[model samples]
Target: MRKSAAPFLLALALPLAALAQAPVQYSLAFPNAVHHEARITVVFAEVPAAGPLQVRMARSSPGRYALHEFAKNVYDVQATDSKGQPLTVTRPDSYGWDVSGHDGTVRFTYTLFGDRTDGTYAGIDQRHAHLNMPATLAYARGLEQRPAEVKFELPTDWQVATQLRPDANGTYYAPHLQYLMDSPTSLGAQQRRTWQTLGRTIEMSVLHEGTAAELDAYVEQSKKVVQEAAAIFGGLPEYDFGRYTFVANYLPQTSSDGMEHRNSTSLTSNRPLRGAGALDNLGTVAHEFFHSWNVERIRPRDLEPFDFERANMSNSLWFAEGFTQYYGELLLRRAGIYTDEQYCQEALNGLVGAMLNSPGAARFSPVQMSQQAPFVDAAAAIDPNNRGNTYLSYYYIGGANALALDLELRQNHKTTLDAYMRAVWQQHGQTQRTYAPANPYTLTDLQRILGEVSKDTAFAGRFFRQHLLGHELPKFDQLLAPAGLLVRRAKAGQASLVARLSFNPADSTATVGSTLVGSPLYQAGLDREDVVRKIDGQRLTSAKALPELLAAHKPGDVLTVEYRTRGGIRTAPVTLAEDPTLEVVTYETARRPVTRAMKKFRAEWLSGKAKSFYPKPQPEDKDVSG
Candidate 1:
């Protein structure tokens, strides 16, 4: 996209009416749902008498930071006046169409092509329509504050599920365009459940070809997740839309994704809810539910008025997204959905693979990782880069950093991270205040809050400088020591191999994906993409063969390896060494003795017994609803 555009001059037009219409209206019909398309007509009830009125499709949407170029999905646009006379509509760009000579009422119709369903994209099919408003509706220029109403025309049995305020006539109302886009509407056969607690209502509407009993069980567990998340924030934030909705679509053809919104969220997966992969959906649920306050409210100022024309970038995503990722898993454990051992395994995978063992840890910082989000955060392209060797995901780094910071607060200061998070919520995300790009918290603000919460400014400065800005990571073995848990290679005490290679069936060759930075493989000129053709004069068809050939050999054996490099076929006489890869981490608990203080810290951090729920849960020994 070009960095500059024509100056917007809609204000130069004269007002045709004494007062603007109350709500800019949109009428949507899915008569051709069988063809995977929908007909949408938007009415700008109060257009200026003359000058070009700009109506454009968004280039991106909230909770997403890529250039989607939504205009590509729209076509066959037609415009007219209220009296049915055709109006001249000019195409200014791929995303915009300018209209003139409207009698204070501008109406346009367009066909939208939607076949994919995810948290960030819109999908329309014969059975249902998933609306991410930015991808579904076009907004008139300079009228962002205008209230809007949406009317859907579809099968009578197909119910409407959204966070928008519903009117008696079946239309939905939004205070402004921002709220409208933030509200996603799911129309189809929905299995709905509502639970009221603490003077607020939480709703779940699932669209799947599954039994209702599984949904009931899911709703019961979700209730516990909600309770635990609120306990961390002191209380749930004020939901301006009167409720928080969880809209999930689990179908065989749908894509998997979970996107967070201000008052609602979309969760989709291809796994069967009652079959083997059912439990996977619960993790995305725990993650998005916590976002009702994290990025949705305690947002990055730059992402506030979410840009629909370009990518929205923020340096604070390490906390905005990473800290949220941290609590998502933590809340699941606190709710008793995940056992202590299970939680430890989750920690080991992220801590070791993302921070400790990852070669990128020595090359990148959390801030640098967050800056790469626009390119890697679910980007559509499939180009390969140095991710395995020179890059790390902020999700991993941030989550690990959050875990270390949390354990440090509990172990050394006898304080918890929950109190600090609540302080942030109260100051940045409490009431009806809508944050914008100009009003976000900076890195300085985060350090200030940490200092205030920990009552140690010097500690805050040291933590950020040494651990955050630097490549060094927090020591997890020492941190996990307090929980009576330990992490080691899953192959430890069994095998002596650590090399990792992936096989390509198409070429019948093995390729090295990762190896110890300074190990023998690195010293022998085995680059990442070097195709291994043979080892010790033996043919190698699969990566499995490498381990089999070396099974009889001990450490410190010199061997000849032949492979194809980018330059050409080459043979290197490399010295064989013990494998140095930690493929999987083993998390063991209750295998060691636990001290009294260690027991207390684990109890308080792992379980929310340190703080009580608003409506206290049943017996402390009871597990979450099964």
Candidate 2:
């Protein structure tokens, strides 16, 4: 028996080696790219002798809260066994196909029709194939924990751009299904720039119809953004494969969008790397890069295990997305892309104005508003809803709160939001397990960390209760005072209906787009689609007529208004009110005195926090690796 032990050991080792080599394999080929179609094949091997295997396309992509039903684009699906023999396949649901009699191995193939180029959908053309993984690939149900490998049979002279770790055999690897779904790939003739910082490789792959010189110049600008973003959190996150990627597609055929992933970002725009469009596009760069830390790593618990089966709802997007929105523009200022006056006028002014004037902010707290993301975060429907009147984007609400909280921390606690962010990174985002975050944060964790950073539990509790859970906004005028920024009424002493109106010259009627709640128009029972025939007995002949009528009156003045509703023409006595819009301007711009204290406050708040770490990128350092 001892002499024959070798044969027994060989039998056990055979299946172990087979299991080790059995990964969910996926191969993509664009045979009909001109028609926006890709042929995809997935191989599931060593299936543990399971009776049936369920394969399906993801319903929703990451960084999106809506259910997109990606299965709608998949067709011509077929399956086979290990020996290339036909397997019996049955449609169990709209999204999945069940395969039986697979002999412990199943090969699934399908055709994916994709036409849109954005962060949430797949786009294919003669020029390139932009693929969001969840939209392009299918996965086997019980094989989620197995390693996944992707091989792209690219077009001539085309290469792949993705965060997926690559092997010498031209195959990309993901630890598991979660990482596989989050990786988006861009296949094209890409121009890329690579650099090393903090012992990590950072790559920017741009697929555009631009010159090499233009890409080099844009790389310089983007370098500044990356450095400034890293400074806020002390350094770059420890990337899984010791690399991070920016997959950008700036072409006329692509849609404008920026989506965040764990180790990379998808930046797409219909703008080129020339003129004002370049800087405008860079704004999205700062935003999605910041998300690598905020939403991708310092994640909300509601989104920790992102579900691909249905709509993913979260109540902390105000902090996840809104705070990131705040830093998106702020980081530009710190990087010197925006002057102080420009930052105050554009970013600060917009945030304060929306929070001050929006009826949604007044009606819903940040938490409540964030819960509405599943309905409004790019969700589509034919019938209209009252989102215009009831929704204030969590981005603006959270940004305004960040502005206030940052000031409060600086003035009262002698700390900065930067410090609190570092604390959050250390506690929740710094530690990681290969593919996902190990300590993704929760709402309670955010409050607790704020308390720890500020050394004031009571202040943190009060702030969260008042601004986050309650619909109470901080006084922006007072918060901006120390920094010598002014928050004042834009149109003081002027009467306004405070509603957006579209004038139709054909009928000489003004259509009310959406009436702000609590505004004069809202008080007068005017809503969306109502046609205003006259104001103060004057015909609304053009866009200027309503402003002229408002100018002739003052706040608290009553005027006769005639309008058309679904019930027909109606008349009401409308009491006009002062325009509630707010604006932010530096004290210097406002012709107010800027003292030494104000200068110090502004410098501390706006200046760059870290030294430059990247060397000047050279044109010769271009990397075209897929």
Highest lDDT among the candidates is held by which one?
2
Cα deviation at 127, candidate 1, in Å, is 1.5
Weakest lDDT window of 10 consecutive positions for candidate 2: 3-12
Tell me how far the alpha carbon of residue 163 in candidate 2 is from the true structure, in angstroms, after superposition.
0.4
Estimate candidate 2's alpha-carbon lDDT, on a 0 to 1 scale.
Answer: 0.87
* Candidate 2 collision pairs: none
lDDT of 2 by residue, 309-357 (tens): 7788898999999999999999889988889988987699889999988
Residues 1-626, candidate 1, lDDT per residue (tens digit)? 24422222232132533224457899989988988798999988767676877898988788877778788989999999999899999998889899988988888899998888887778888889888888889988766666789999978778888888889998998877778888888889877888675567778888888788888777777878888888888777678767888988888778998889888898889887764456578878889999998888887766666666777787777788888889888887888877776776664466555677777777888888888888777667876676767777787888888888998888777677888788777766674443222245677888888888898899988888877777778887788777766655544433332456777777767887665565667778888788888778987766577678787676677788888989999998777665443432222333566678776767888885324655544343232222
CA lDDT of every candidate: 0.77, 0.87
Top of the candidates by TM-score: 2
